[model samples]
Target: MSVATLHYIHDPLCGWCYAAQPLVSAMQAQLGDRLALRLHGGGLFGEPRRVDAALAQHIVHSDERIAQLSGQPFGEAYKQGLLADEGTVLYSLPPIAAVLAAESLDAAKAYPMLAAIQNAHYQRGLRVVEPQVLTELAEEIGLDGTHFAQALARADGHTLFEHVQASRRLLDEAGGHGFPTLLLEVDGRRTLLPHHHYYGRPDAFVQMLAGQLPAVH
Candidate 1:
């Protein structure tokens, strides 16, 4: 019998991805070895885009909306401390590269590392651009900080570009052009997983997955 795989493609800086984390975790726990999970880094920001006044306000409002809908916490500090700094650049490649590096070392650690980066950004208001911050997150996820840092530094230029290219290819192939999209592949067939509306219960997501993919064993 062939095993089924779940490919969760998302961007690290995406709010909806943050909201879906718990639901993915629940599905993984229930599905166990019947499911093989893979993380694809969907690059949300390709270049260093300046956060203009309008964009900043939009981000602040989007963060609030995500918090309200997903029950994910967003503190005033995240808005005031991080977003208030006008020069804050939004380039997610570095952090996304860090996740890919961690996955190379140990696949199971990807989600935890992703969560650590998110918490550092949205919860603690830390700038994820700094290498020190990424290294600290690596340590927190049981990865060799030095190795992870070296991998990130080496891959900072070309490897990340390649990963983003792969992500783009996947997105194009799947005909998906949205953040927080979930694609599950079973028996060589790929299908989109249904997502609950922005603020719906995570359990609703679990039920949807359960109905779509039953246990193989």
Candidate 2:
């Protein structure tokens, strides 16, 4: 089978990344074995910050805009439950670390684990920055909890720093500004797929990206 790789460079905490989730899923399903997708985490909040009253409000506003534009879900739990809190600082490392861990242990689990993080954060009103929370989420998705816990705990500074560096390298190499960037790679060549259409019509988006895939005999 002829196959190509799709490089997804994104921050797990990014609103736009969450918005693009469904589209990416649809693309993978349509492409089947014709596509190989890799997930990369960009450290958007390398230096974490507490979601203060003002910042929380701003996050809600920005996420709302993303939801409207992309037709993605921004539940009341996220807007009212999570964002209403002032004590929680938003950090990107824990979730990124968890994703990398999943990728290492079982590559197939990586994207599912990421979707779990986004769902936990936006739909379930869960604070995903805590290692324990990530462990529980991974376990809930049928991943080995012990392995996940170890991975979560052992994600030392260097490990996380390397991931952040790698994320930045992919972004710079792709000439992308930031998160939720998708690149289609075939035979060592790369092309950036315009992510706008993926937000609305994923089937059409996949068709545009894959370009008239062969029919089943």
Candidate 3:
């Protein structure tokens, strides 16, 4: 019996990463027990170095393109509510920290919480920068709110910083193009999978892996 590892490199605040969620979910379902699906946080955004009309316009345009390609929903609330609201820059540290905090408590909750956070931001236009909002989300997902809050309180500490660094290292090792990168590894050797497999037909993703690796029986 052979086992393959699929590493999904993503960031919670990445629009493209959110767009790839369905594809990743399908991959998880189709692969079943044939492979290990590992989630890695790729650092994509930072404190608002420069966010203005040009950046906002580019974001909307890119989001539209992603929607067209992936058939993923980018709600009007996200556009009109979050994007229209000013004083909100492209900050990612808090969301990533929340993911790390969840992972610390329960590894299984991390990726699911990532999906929930993405939905909360992309659909509901809820604030991801606020610890309070993230805590509420944690509670909604059955995570211990007090524990999540304590971990988030230590967001600026070494633990979260180490998670960020580890993600960056994995991303670089995979030679990822951007967020939502996928890599396959078997017997200690790694191979980068094309992003197109995740676009609209995730079934094709399953077929592609089946052709290259052991089939899930």
On lDDT, the candidate that comes out on top is 2
lDDT of 1 at 86: 81
The per-candidate count of clashes, in order, stands at 0, 0, 0
Best-to-worst TM-score order: 2, 1, 3
lDDT scores in order: 0.78, 0.84, 0.80
RMSD to native for every prediction? 2.0, 1.9, 2.2
Winner on lDDT between 2 and 3 is: 2
Residue pairs in collision within model 1: none
Give the higher-TM-score candidate: 1 or 2.
2
Model 3, 49-96: lDDT tens digits are 344677778888988988898888887888987887666666677888
Off by over 4 Å in 2: 212-217
Q: On residues 1-217, what C-alpha lDDT tens digit does candidate 2 reach at each position?
A: 5467888998889998998888888877878578888888888888888888888878878887888877888778888888887877789888999998888788888999999999999988899998889999999888889998887777757987987898789889999868889888877888877886668677778878778344544
Residue 81 displacement (Å), model 3: 0.7
Candidate with the larger TM-score of 2 and 3:
2
lDDT of 2 at 195: 88
lDDT of 1 by residue, 1-217 (tens): 2277777778888888877777777767777466777778878987777777888899888887788777888766778877888887777888898888788778788878888888888888888777888999999889998899887787678888888888777877887757777787877898977664624476677666667675655
